[model samples]
Every structure is written in C-alpha cells, then in structure tokens.
Target: YVENNLAQKTIELFNELKNPADVNKTLLNQMKLDDIQSSIPIYLSAIKAVSQIGDYSKAQSIFKQIPDSLLVENQIRSALIDLWGKVGSVVEAKLIFDKIRQPNIIEYTTMGLF
Candidate 1:
C-alpha cells in the first residue's frame, strides 16, 4: 500500500490490526518477538504513508502507537524525521534527529532534505 502511495489504505490497515483495548498493554507483553519484528515494517510504512497524506495529527497518533523499543531504531527515527519534515514540522524532525547517538547516512540524508 505504501509503495503504491495508498496512504489512506495503509493507515486503515494499520488501525484495523491494532486493538485499542490493548492500549494499556505494552507491545512486548501483548505480542511475541516475531510479531513485533514483522510489524516494524508495517509501522514504518504507515509513517511514510502519513507523510504522503500530509496528516500531521494522524502521524503523531500513529507514532504514539509504536513501541518504545522500535522508536530507538535508526530506520524508524529516520522515517520519522522525514514524516515530520513533510508535515511542516522541522522542529519536531530536528528533535528526533538530535536524540540519535550516532546518526547514519540515511538519517543524515533524510534530515538534510528538510
């Protein structure tokens, strides 16, 4: 869905898979290791889709759904920087960028584009 630029569809599918009732449960407690690993790609795709749709609020909402474990991943953080920049929030992007202990090429490239 993301590759095709189907932002809305991507968002819908993500929302459908997540159970709101599980809000209080940490992802680690709710899902297996494999499940979390597999969902990482989908989460990343959804972030990119949110950017394509230019829905800053939705982007933040989806961001809050992500497990803290995943947030530290460079790939996820890089995508977030791109998402924030696309949504007209350079400050948010910079904040995420600054948190990286050792930003990689992809992170630099994404942040540099802003």
Candidate 2:
C-alpha cells in the first residue's frame, strides 16, 4: 500500500502506533523492501533520523539502500543532496550533486545550501 512505503505515511503510522520502536522499525523496513520506489523518501527520512541520532554510518546505509532510479528523481535527489549536506557527508553530497543533469533552480539552491 502507498501508506506503508511513503515516508510521511510511515512516520505518521510510527507516531500513531504506540508499540515498541523495534516493531515500527521492522515494519518500515519490510515496507521499504516491498516497495522500493515508494520507499525512497522513507529511506531518506530514515537516513535523516539516523544521522540526527548521530548514526552517520547507519544513515549512509539507508541512503545507499535507495534504488538508483528513485535517487535520480528531482525531488528525491534534491532531498538526498540536502540530507547529505546537512549531515556533513561531503563526498556523498558532492557525488549526488555531480550526478544531476540540467538541474533546475530548486536543485541548484539545494546544492548551494550545503
């Protein structure tokens, strides 16, 4: 279901479900594998959360888990670039920025913000 793999939806469900965090984490990961396309943002959010929690390695793994196709999308690429930048992932962020072709103003701004 779209509800399961969407980042906002996954986050929303996690907030609503008062079960153990492990349960939510497992469910989210399952949803991600089940729908990699829809799960791109979910993976990004996971990366952001892990990074914020001081788990840069985990965040990198989550970011790496994103499908290549999804990572090329404008919005998703921008988000990943911004995320890498904010987390001080210079190499990852630069690589992502370099891969963008014909980037628009938003993407330019996002890369610049790093």
Candidate 3:
C-alpha cells in the first residue's frame, strides 16, 4: 500500500501548492521524507506543481534530487525542458536538450518550438 500512500500524498502536495494561498515550503520538506529513489514520480509531480505555481526555487531543489540518468528519460526530460524554459533559462534548457540521446520528433519539435 506504499504506492497508494505515495499517490495520495502526491495529490495532496499538488493541491497544497496549487492553492491560491501562499505555499508552505514545510509541506514540501515533509514530502521529501518519502524514499526519493523509489518516489521519483511523486517528486516529479511536485516539481511540476511548483513550476506551475512559479515556485522555481523549490522546483529546482526537487529537480536536483533526480539523477542525470533519470533526467534522460523522455517524460522527465520534457518536464525539465519546460521547467527551464518557464524559468527563463533557455541556455539550461538547451544544455539538457543537447544531452538527450535519440530524442524523438516530439522532443525535437518541442525544442524548436519552445
């Protein structure tokens, strides 16, 4: 039931961050109590939430926990690219883009379009 808990916690974290009220970073810190290596999906979900709320500092902090190998995965890479672009770091986005191996047409198109 660990997976279930993780999924539920992830949803809670997303909602808390998405609320119009100010975010409580403490909540994020608490979420990090979960096993990060196994909870990459939840962590990534939090990253997306923070990014959407313009909380790049917190999002970057979470992103850093994801290893380069994980970052290379298509789904994660797309999120990171978008995050970097959202934060006005086109150079960083390009750096990640350059490191991608066998980028599909969608990825290529995203790079060109973004």
Q: How many residue pairs clash in each candidate?
A: 0, 0, 0
What's the residue-level lDDT of 16 in candidate 2?
65
Q: How do these models rank on TM-score, best leading?
A: 1, 3, 2
Q: Candidate 2's residue-wise lDDT over 1-114, tens digit each? A: 454345766566667665333333455566667654345555555555654554456557566566777877877777777777777786887888888878889888988887
Identify the leading candidate in terms of lDDT.
1
Q: Provide the global lDDT of candidate 1 against the true structure.
A: 0.71
Off by over 4 Å in 1: 1-38
Model 1 lDDT at residue 34: 25
**TM-score of model 2 relative to the true fold?**
0.64
For model 2, what is the alpha-carbon lDDT of residue 95?
Answer: 88
Best by TM-score: 1
lDDT of each: 0.71, 0.65, 0.64
**Tens digits of per-residue lDDT for model 3 on 1-114?**
144456666557657665521233434455457534434465466557656776657656767766666776787777777777777677877887998878887778767766
- Span of 10 residues, lowest total lDDT, candidate 3: 19-28
State in Å the error of residue 88, model 2: 0.9
Please tell me which model should have the higher TM-score, number 1 or number 2. 1
Tell me the spans in candidate 3 whose CA falls farther than 4 Å from its real position: 1-37
TM-score against native, each model: 0.67, 0.64, 0.66
